[model samples]
Target: MIAISDPIRIEPWNFAPERSNFPTRNLPNRRAEIAREKQLTTLIRENNRSRRTCASKIAEMAKKAGIEVKPLEIEFIAARAGIAIS
Candidate 1:
């Protein structure tokens, strides 16, 4: 018989790379960019409707599979669906 004491051990590594020296491009006009952002927001909202439906289906499937789902997981799914949970 083997006694299991520690489940796992972790070691930290410092692997950060130095920043690049590439020159950035000039951004577009603020007003035009704002308009584009609004359009993107609308598109994201519309897409999230379908995503929410998918999330609900996934939750149902998880329940059927006997997997325990936490409220935080549900909230994360809701956030991805663009549905605010507060």
Candidate 2:
């Protein structure tokens, strides 16, 4: 027969990743790019327009609204949003 003095042991976790050996990521911020993609998606769905037309329209509107947006940025947004570039 075996006799155990203490059967259970409990330890508290601090949950500090910085203190522990956890790897941290240093990723770039892409909020603006993501926001632009969402806007492009909405515009495409609303008008059922092609990439070129949408890009031109967005550029014109941005120009009128005093926002500096380039045509290439629009193309990238369309591409990121999975819209067909025509």
Candidate 3:
């Protein structure tokens, strides 16, 4: 009869999942909102300047043509010209 061989043994160990101690906040979304607001503000300012320039040009043209035009009338006409303020 042949001699019997010993069987291999395996070791067992305890494993635990990792945990975090700090809470997370949605900071990136807030930053994006603030950035969009700033961009809109800048666009409004630029649009206002452009509107004023266009109004001034119209007033100058009317004046050179010897036509009577009031400042309030020019302002009203310019206000009717819509700008993409968004």
**Every model's TM-score:** 0.28, 0.43, 0.30
Give per-residue CA lDDT, model 3, range 37-74, as digits (tens): 45433433444664444545554556676745554555
Which regions of candidate 2 fall more than 4 Å away from where they truly are? 1-33, 47-54
| lDDT on C-alpha atoms for all candidate structures | 0.48, 0.60, 0.47
Q: How many backbone clashes does candidate 1 have?
A: 0
Question: What is the C-alpha RMSD, rounded to one decimal, of candidate 3?
Answer: 23.8
Q: Which scores greater on TM-score, model 2 or model 3?
A: 2
Which digits, one per residue and each the tens of the lDDT, describe model 1 over residues 1-86?
Answer: 76688577664343323222321322344455556445434433444554544544544555565644544565464565466434
lDDT of 2: 0.60
Error of 3 at 34 (Å): 0.6
Q: What C-alpha lDDT does candidate 3 achieve relative to the native structure?
A: 0.47
